[model samples]
Target: MALQNNEKFDIKIVYDKFEAALHEEDDIHLQFYLESFEELNKFFTLMGTVFGFVSKDLKAKMDILNEFLKDSNKSENFITVKKMIEYEKQNELLNKKGYTSGSRTLLRLHRGLDFIQLFLKKLGDLRDEESTSSACREAYDQTLAKHHPFVIRNGAKVAIYTLPTREILLKKVCGELDNIQKAMNLLPETLEVTAVVHTRIEKLYTVHDLHRLP
Candidate 1:
């Protein structure tokens, strides 16, 4: 995954995209949510090939959401997370066994977002000598790992070891700055905004009882 607009990786960009994703207090705009993930894909790409699975999964999920925006029948329903849930539930599309309903697809991305949020928070708290791999692994264990089976858990254990050192990881994500400290300072706001987006989506899922969609 190449950086969009040939741009450098910056935590501030991720922060802004996430903050832009929220609207009307509780509504989340799908386009901005995916755009934020596009910026996040760069973070995974910068880490190395070991994290390619993470990036590829996000790219695929983003493509699915983009398709919803393009489809004439579904586009209107997908403008906001709330609308997508209401529309999909009303139409009996949320649990059709194999159907790729917008609600179910976004739920996958929502889970991924949880992993990203936790990973970044851990990364931000690490000292210069701390292991980036440990942060990645811990974040995965707390979030995505619960949904993944044995094969993926084992694969992730190997893949996380390929992450660069804490200092280097900071350099890659905050590369736009001469001093990585500036970027580190942005993490709190970024995490807060992302938490709000995640919570909003989570509430929509709980309200509609769609958390168990498979």
Candidate 2:
């Protein structure tokens, strides 16, 4: 769909709704870009990741463009992400030879992946925080561990359901992580999970460390 700013949509309400969606673990808004600010947030992360993956150096420069776009910062020359992706792809095609795929298709793919990233982040964060116990089952559960039955007398004796944290991550977050890790040189398990989560969630993107990324 064509994009335009609809003044009727309140940015403040959308912002608050975005946070509340996280807190409440809702997915309706995540399904569609109903809120403009949130839409931008998702788009930015996707753009950042795609740009980041293609070249470490280029990612850093494009990030300046994103930082400038921040509403908190006063800046001139707003740029559309689509246009930026288009331009970057064109340059890549012109400067290089033996192209593997069309630049236009790649650009669209990156932008589309960013959209997927935004939704997954909101979706996964909801459960990781909300479903898992407080502080990810580290709080009262730890204290109450003594009280909880370590082993069942007769039943399954399930203290905590044993689940491969990575499996949950794959199902809920980015399936791409699983594929990339298996295909590419082995990355630290945590990095793989984090990469998956980063694509799906925003807080990870904001974090400082690349390894600690997400």
Candidate 3:
């Protein structure tokens, strides 16, 4: 069945919107675009359904951080990542075990996003089913494995083994086997855009980490 207009996934638009919002230097101190987190959750659900457990964990973190932003006072709003980091610094809330603060929670989500980006980019480059599966495993090892517990890592590996063949992925994303080349072309572009966004966010997190140090 053909995907409905609303159901169609456009990675470029999603990544671009996030890039614009995140790179708004003048707005770093202003309120974050709250709806962006909602959009991001949708993206995760769309891309990570095969790895349901991972998606669930990511959704939980995103929800917690978004709720924190929604509930913040005017002066202490956790809108931008920078503002979130600033609030955490002023309140001394970083690194508190068993406590959920916006900065730390967002950092977790950011790590998850990095994994998703890596997996998608790798999947985008596949030439066959075996390659697709290999890419997923490699991406998982390179990114998420370090963060996930042993059980979750093993579970993810099991899920990777169940991934649909490259032909199926092409048809799912590009809408037809005849359009496989189009899908292949699209993935690299998507990966490039996603990498740019990921790099920017990682840099922001790095800066936040440096500031947290003495």
Candidate 4:
């Protein structure tokens, strides 16, 4: 697939979708969360093949949740994070592996979201001419690296070195901005909104004790 130009993506759209995903304070609307994640994937896409594996991994996780939403019999249970957990657990559907239940699938995506939130915070904190690869490495180490196997980590270590410096990456993902400084300025609000959605999902998994799902 051809990579979409950065002009086609607005970083703020990710923040907006995540903000909308928050429902009734602690609850998250599943559809909005999926949509926000889909938007966030564009950032990886815009970065080019260096992060293709990250984007592919995230898409696979989202596809699982979308399948749950498409099932007529179980669609109601998949409408919100809270509902999905209750329905899946009450039915004893989470005992199996390989994302056989909504809870398990969403847990994978939630971990990916944590990596993204951490990555953005690191990106926002970078000084001039710093390597974006370091931010990617640090974020991956803290989040997804824990859940991933040795082979995946080895692959990511190679990909990380191919990333552009902070200035170039900011321009690639934030092409709509007048300059790199404006893009840097946009990161705080972006991270703030994303953190709220991440925290809600994190709490949901914590409450259900689903973090260790295979």
Candidate 2 local lDDT, 8-124, one digit each (tens): 212233334434323222111221222323333332233223222223322343344445446353222223323323344445542355632222232233333343333334333
By TM-score, rank the candidates, best first. 1, 4, 3, 2
lDDT for each candidate structure: 0.83, 0.31, 0.61, 0.83
The backbone clash count of each candidate, in order, is 0, 3, 1, 0
Scanning candidate 3 in windows of ten residues, the lowest lDDT window is: 26-35
Q: Which 10-residue window in model 1 sums to the lowest lDDT?
A: 1-10
Model 2 weakest 10-residue run by lDDT: 205-214
Model 2, position 41: C-alpha lDDT score: 36
Model 2: pairs clashing at backbone N, Cα or C within 3 Å: 121-200, 121-201, 204-214
Per-residue lDDT tens digits for candidate 1, residues 1-214, read: 6665445567777789888889797899988888888878777877668887788888888898999999997698898999988988888887787788888888888899999999988888888787899889999999999998899889988988878778877776556446477677777988899899999999888988888988
The TM-score obtained by model 4 is 0.91
Candidate 4 residues 1-214, lDDT tens each?
2454435446667777888888997999999889888878878877888888888878888888999899998899989999999998887889854447778878888888899889989888887599899889999999999988999899999999888888778777767447556656677998988888888888888888888877
Superposed model 1: Cα runs more than 4 Å off? 4-7, 176-179
TM-score of each: 0.92, 0.20, 0.75, 0.91
Error of 2 at 44 (Å): 16
Query: Cα RMSD to native, each candidate?
Result: 2.0, 19.7, 4.6, 2.1
**CA lDDT of 24 in candidate 4?**
95
As a TM-score, model 3 comes out at 0.75
RMSD of candidate 3 to the true fold?
A: 4.6
List residue ranges in candidate 4 displaced over 4 A.
1-7, 96-99, 176-182
Which residue pairs collide in model 4, if any? none
